[model samples]
Target: MKKQITFSIFITMLLLTACQERTTQQIIKLTNPSDFDRVDEPIVLARNIFTIKDIPNKNCIVLDKDQRAIPFQLDDLDEDGQWDEMFLLVDLKKKEQIDIIVMWTDQMSNKQFRQRANVRFANKAGDKILNDVNRLRSTDTKLSQAEFQMEGPAWENDVVAFRNYFDARNGIDIYGKRTKEMILHKVGINGQNYHQLDDWGMDILKVGTSLGAGAIAISSGDTLYRVDLPETSTYHLLVNGPLRSVFDLKHHNFKIGDHQLNINHRISIWGGAACYKSSVTIDGLQGNDALVTGIVNLHSDTYIEEKADQYLILATHDIQAEDQAALGMALLAKSKDVIDVSEAPKEGSGIVSTYLLKLKAENNKPTNFYFYAGWATQDKGYTDKSYFMKRLKKDAMRWSRPIIIK
Candidate 1:
């Protein structure tokens, strides 16, 4: 009886231990490791309820499909208060693109947390990531500015391409040297220069250039872009993908033929197609009142003139509170100077239509100004030309020039 009783106690203890071990296993959780096939799985992260998958042959982990939101803590790596939820491991699969959805709890009172992000996948095949890097480098000129110290296969292309890659990857746009003309070389299949064909683009194309200005052009495919370097530097960015859309930090992109001065960063100049042939003159300071002065000459082969006509100018200085009211009025009243409008003279003779502007002063220091001149007809809007004539008269009005009647 004693032996049987002892054996029964031992058996009960063993069962109890086994039950406790199973309970412990249930409580422990494992983080899902990223792997090849399911690199972009819909991540349902919340407080609880998630499963993991292991691909030993491939050596990866994948999250099982769970639409249910599981709570997870956001690890603020940057410490800026913005939380980073989860990072997905991506690999080339499907079209090398995968869409992922993150069901997160929203901090708002709505009591919901749901979000989604599309993470792209790269091929395990031939230098997939490296090739992407090269594609971006081919268009950016700034990347070439860096003196590459790391040794490797000498990059055959220009440094702009490499710089573009770095900037694009870092969410910045790299600009190349800005010039009025760009020359493109086309090589034939036989490794000979194909300069004979006119459409082949072996010849240089002349694009208009504005003074102290910059511009950006996006390709039709939206896969690549060309950014004119800041006036401060002679560079341009031929950027691939989305990095081509960033704006220049220094110069403003002007769209109108005329503008005004203000502490505001962006100023719009408005006019019509008549502004095209119109000559423009900008008079502004370089450091004090206005950091820049520019004109947006709209040139087009078609007469549609339907595109938005506006000039965007940026100001560098901050204006005082008292000055803000007057400045705002000046901007609205087109108090900023522009060139005068005049008719083109008979073909041969040099009948120059001159426009003049005066520099007014506030504290004995001359205030900045500008002038613009152009030729356009009544059909294109701006028939009266009253504004142009009035501004010209005001600018050239005779001041205190003392003279004796002879």
Candidate 2:
């Protein structure tokens, strides 16, 4: 009787233990699997209270030159119940904690938020969010400039993981400088020093030797070319003047010695004016004089300046044949039939001649409009007389439709 009772009890206990183990496995499988601890993996002590003590006095943190931070949006980041990664945004203008973005590991996680600390920035002028790694690395060496350490996952924290994430997000590896496509902050080399380039020429680069970006420059006899770089990257190098001709003035692919630097540019003009109607006081009507003034209507004025054999080519494009003829006749005091006789392209996509028209004012009265129109070089000359006539004509047609600036 004793043996039977003991055996029965043992069997029941074993069955219950088995049931409990199965239940635990089901819960683990259902709740979340990524949180499972792998063999020999070190457990991360989750960060509970993350705080930024100090922020820079400056109103902005310029990345390269552009400001990246807007008002922080906490809701923008996804979050989970258990502690995960988060972002702390410090608004420099308000001089307070702007937002906390809780990033989550799972799909259905909720985030929490808190207000700014009672301790403000006035007494904490030099105090800033110190970076742990930077402090450790530069323990003996003092920084030349005020170094506010930025704390977060470094770019190379997990090279494989980061590469995956970065490639997923931006779809390119900018640091590597290759892939299907890319975007880079470019600086051109001139001799020993590297200068930042604008559309027209070189400017002081933001990343000099001081920033560890290295000294980049265009050397003597070395023409700055962008072709050696990738297919669709932005070049910070500009084409400086006093030239052996503007080779790739506004072109993408061209050769410059051993290297080929592709060119992309943003072209703009200023201080030019326009006259809408035809009248006397029109300069450079026929004579070889460099400066010419012309009135479109009885009142509107336009000026032209000659550069070498070519008048400064202002704006040139294509327009409709009929409309252009009407405008040419109206502006030039020529017959509409004569205007129609002008050799323009077919009814569609005909070229319209344009010039740089400048208008300035002294006090309140409207000053005269100065303008220019002609070819740049004989090699770069207009293919037809009609192209020049359209611009030269004072009554050149302008569409009444609204031109959208932006």
Candidate 3:
């Protein structure tokens, strides 16, 4: 009788241990250390912060102070089976602290949330459409550009959308939206006309070899070289979020004065914003290399420049949009990173007719910048120069000083 009783006790303890392992909870404290209110601030948490086996594989549940479920995503940044990081968009007042309850479980949740941002990389695969990164990076630039939807990879948030020429030109373009609906996946393909005004919006910007938007390059001396037509390239959709989406592009064998380097650009877009964050990293980097990005200047010679709160705002408001309407574009960056702000030669062999931003970079270090596009038809407030500047400043502050997470 005593032996049977001990066996029962041992079984009960084993079951209890299994149950505890099946479900685990963690408390994450996030503080808005800035004086300004943090509205929809993006936060990233690496999986290395916790023990790998402690969190279950499939489900991640996050709760707020009131036990309200918050929308979040687990991302496998390296395309490995295990998730490497967590993404969440948080809101808090100045100096406010919010405690987040995170629970990992073996069970999945059926909870659904409104999607605010998206990523689309569609290519023709016979009768099927797929995001085959290799298909768009072929040597046949012109043919592939026509075959791919939106001429390349396109991503969007609620009100703003942007596309890249997966071809050798390697430029960025914008699609201004009337409604907050995610519509790029539907409109850009299947013989549809996006150049004209639709209920959603139209392709409002024209890109002509000029960086077009916030496209990047490398600068040596006074000449610039495009990070295009590489020997190999790949596109990865890192995270597709209900509040934010992240996509990455890899360029291998880009030549700069006979020195080859691999470059990676990871861009993230968030909800309710007309701008996107671009982070660029280079392999085989040298400290002397200058990273460059810019806005097209063919239609506007006069640009409004501002230095505010540790950032430089290089912007242009003009009647230069494709629809002949006023559009405002701005590039925001840290003042310290920018070494030169000048114009590429109006008629040159390299990237010309663009206002250039030459940035300081060290070996293998990442350089980041945010690009903004505001169309008058989409937001009449953008027609006013003052309102455009104010919007850029607010966003700059929010991105530069994100909420502190402990």
User: In model 3, what is the error at residue 58, expressed in angstroms?
Assistant: 5.9
Stretches of candidate 3 exceeding 4 Å from the true structure:
1-22, 50-53, 124-129, 135-145
For residues 112-208, could you state the per-residue lDDT of candidate 3 as single tens digits?
6679899887763323344547524443545865677667788899879998888777889898899888897677555667898988899988777
The parts of candidate 1 lying over 4 Å away from their true place are 1-204, 208-231, 234-302, 307-406
Number of colliding residue pairs in model 1? 41
lDDT value, residue 331 of candidate 1: 10
RMSD to true structure for each model, in Å: 24.4, 28.1, 7.4
TM-scores, all models, native as reference: 0.19, 0.15, 0.88
Per-residue lDDT of 226 in model 3: 81
Q: For residues 1-406, could you state the per-residue lDDT of candidate 2 as single tens digits? A: 5754654464334335434422110100011112221111111112333232221111111111121221211211113433232122221221121222221111221112222111111111223321111111222112311231111111110000001000001110001111111111121212211122233112111111110011011111412211122323221211111110000112222233444333322111111111111111211112111111111211112222222111222222222121121111111222211111111112222111112122111222212221222221211233354555544542122111111111
lDDT of 2 at 157: 8
Hey, what RMSD does candidate 1 come out at?
24.4
Candidates' C-alpha lDDT: 0.21, 0.19, 0.80
**Against the hidden true structure, what lDDT does model 2 obtain?**
0.19
Best by TM-score: 3
